[model samples]
Target: MIQRIQTIYLLIASIVSGGLIFVFNLWKTLKEQIFVLDLFEEGLFTLNVVPFMFITSSILSLVTIFLYKNRKLQFVIGRIIILMNLFLLGLLIYLSLTLSGETIVSEKGIGMFLPILVVLLIVLANKAIKKDEDLVKSVDRLR
Candidate 1:
């Protein structure tokens, strides 16, 4: 149901991946320039994928939330979302580390860690979904 704990987690995950990304700066360049890392900015090679991945992750989470009647499918989608977030996290780490000592990126912003938070929330949602599935199976067995 919509009031389930996993639904709340998925909603938060969607908000973090979709909305909060625009609100926070990902990193600052050595030139004191800020990079928000949204879909519109088309400069860096690695960054181009960030926005796409974030949007995909957010969409996946939102879709998974509504698949509550099909717990197995929902769980699988959650796993895919986790993998996407992990890939995004890896890409962000690579970009930050590679650019840190360069003249382009001098400082990383708090938004750089937003994907990590998204991953954590998705995992929690998956766990709760699993628990619900188990509870359902147990009730079926009792009947």
Candidate 2:
């Protein structure tokens, strides 16, 4: 049961995060310019939600591995993993933004692949989450 709940949380977070990338891309297309790599350069973007997402995602991923091994509170652990992933992604976007001396870079040349990569990672994580859930259930049944 715990494993199942964790799996659900992972799936939900993955789906939401993946969906958001698409939505953000659409919004970017409609806008005149997009800020891609502001976080790495200016550091202002780091102050926003992006940094939290990166830190949380990294910690959660590591912690989830331990939790899974110990058969601990899987759901909470999974949520943390998902949140961490989201934050990492947010950070990636923030870092990808390019800026000039006093102006932000134009959006015309922004590559589409980075966002796609982020979505791909989320999808893969969701698949792994399902696999983990299955493994946990099998072990539970054996016990």
Against the reference, the lDDT scores of all candidates come to 0.86, 0.45
The TM-scores of all predictions, comma-separated, are: 0.89, 0.38
Model 2's TM-score against the true structure: 0.38
For residues 25-105, could you state the per-residue lDDT of candidate 2 as single tens digits? 311333353333222343464535553453344345444544555443544555445455545645555544532432533
lDDT of 1 at 24: 81
Stretches off by above 4 angstroms in model 1 are 30-33, 36-40, 43-45
What is the number of residue pairs that collide in model 2? Answer: 10
- Over 14-49, each residue of candidate 1 has an lDDT whose tens digit, in order, gives 999998987787777655545445535767667788
| Residue 105 local lDDT, model 2 | 33
Candidate No. with top lDDT:
1
* Clash total of candidate 1: 0
Clash totals, every prediction? 0, 10
Runs in model 2 deviating more than 4 A are 1-48, 70-76, 83-119, 135-143
